[model samples]
Target chain A: MSRRLAEAFAPGSVAAQVAAADWRAATRVAGELLVASGRTTPAYTEDIIQMLEELGPYQVIAPGIALLHARPSEAVLTTGLSLAVLEKPVEFGSKANDPVRLVFGLAAQHHDSHIEVLAETANKLSSPRFVNSLLTIHSESDFQRLLSDS
Target chain B: MKILAVCGAGVGTSVLLKMNAEKALRTLDLEAEVVAMNLANALEVQDAQVILTTPDLVAKLEGTRSEVIAIEGIFDLNEIGEKLEKALG
Candidate 1:
């Protein structure tokens, strides 16, 4: 586990049932969570938006989760992750996976520096238990428990 | 068998899929080199037997020579592994 990743997904990173009408709003909320935590600059958020505009909305990797991110760049302050669950599910143009409920926004400083963190997240996400926890967690402490236990 | 897990960005989504691919391979007791590549570099996968990716990105490989298997439930290891077994067979 990267120390940077630990800080990024730390206690305060989880937001419960944010109101987002669409992918743009959901992504904005997730990016704002990271920005509020000082993990990424405003430029990082804009970069994510720009990437989506340039490349379509293909970030929804799983059925309910979308891993929102841009490439490693100067816009990032530190490698980190922030997750937001939406009150209403939003579509991100995924054919197999739509109405994504969770957005995990990530920012890395280097291209491959986040492989370990990505791998860890991938491992945890495979579990129905953990993913279910993300959907049900109601408080910051609940989020923290899921983060550490998973 | 040479497999390629592809996504929009080489480093982000591809990396996660690569890890899952590797785990699926291990669980199935199979041996293969799984390389993660971005859409731009997807054309370089001529030597690859199966290309695993999402549905949106699969269209980008419509004319490609390699076999494209669009993964359903992209985050589920069991589903991905089952698809891998079918593809490998």
Candidate 2:
């Protein structure tokens, strides 16, 4: 079965609070999406935050993009992928690539499964068209449709 | 041969690039071990004949002795394979 990616947006949701300079805020927002979408539990949110805190800032990835993820057992309730487009980009280490407006969060039951999905999503994101479409998407439905089409 | 693919977190783009590289190597009649890792662990992973990553990361990894291919776009398997062929040869 194809795992359908979901979107979660709430007023004052973490996704909306991310600033171009706040990496921690972006991670929190990503965690909120996981919890709201039923992909994770409330208790696991702290674990996600911890991973970001320990591995975040510089020397992780570039600045503009934040690859927020956790070990399979720490928080993933299922196998799925999700995306969040920040109204403003945030930083996550990579100085050359900071101020990221797009946050792609991944969760899987195991290592192999996580890698498989990551490979597919990465291939898709490499496409300029796909990246452009993702940036312009305005709603959860739009995001869902993009995943479905892929 | 073993090729270690690297990116920011060893979770997103790097893993994806590993998948693409595996597929491309098969078509090229090349047998290889493709593994993904965070940039921090690249030096730790011995036996990597080649290191594949984005241009931004590649720039940071300059002056390395290992063969390095800076993929402008990791999603494009064709481009990735072409680059691999050049590096592998």
Measured against the true two-chain complex, the DockQ scores of the candidates, in the order shown, are: 0.50, 0.24
Give the native contact fraction of candidate 2.
Answer: 0.22
lDDT of 1 by residue, A1-150 (tens): 334445558556779978898888888888888888777888888888887777767788778888998877777887778889888899987777787998998877776777788877877777888888789877667777667665
**Two-chain DockQ for model 1:** 0.50
How many angstroms is residue A102 displaced in model 1 relative to the true structure, after the best TM-score fit?
Answer: 1.3
Tens digits of per-residue lDDT for model 2 on A1-150? Answer: 145222222222223323434766666666677777667665555765675565443322323445566655756676555456787765565645666877755655565666555555555666677777777777676665676776
- Candidate 2 per-residue lDDT, tens place, B1-89, comes to 88988765566567767887888998888889998877777866656789998766776566655688877555566888898998887
Q: Best candidate per TM-score, number?
A: 1
Per-residue lDDT tens digits of candidate 1, residues B1-89? 89988877677787877888888989999999999877778886678888988766777777777889877665667888998899896
Q: Taking the true A–B contacts (Cα pairs closer than 8 Å), what share appears in each candidate?
A: 0.52, 0.22
The numbered model that scores best in DockQ is: 1
- Error at A136, model 1, angstroms: 3.3
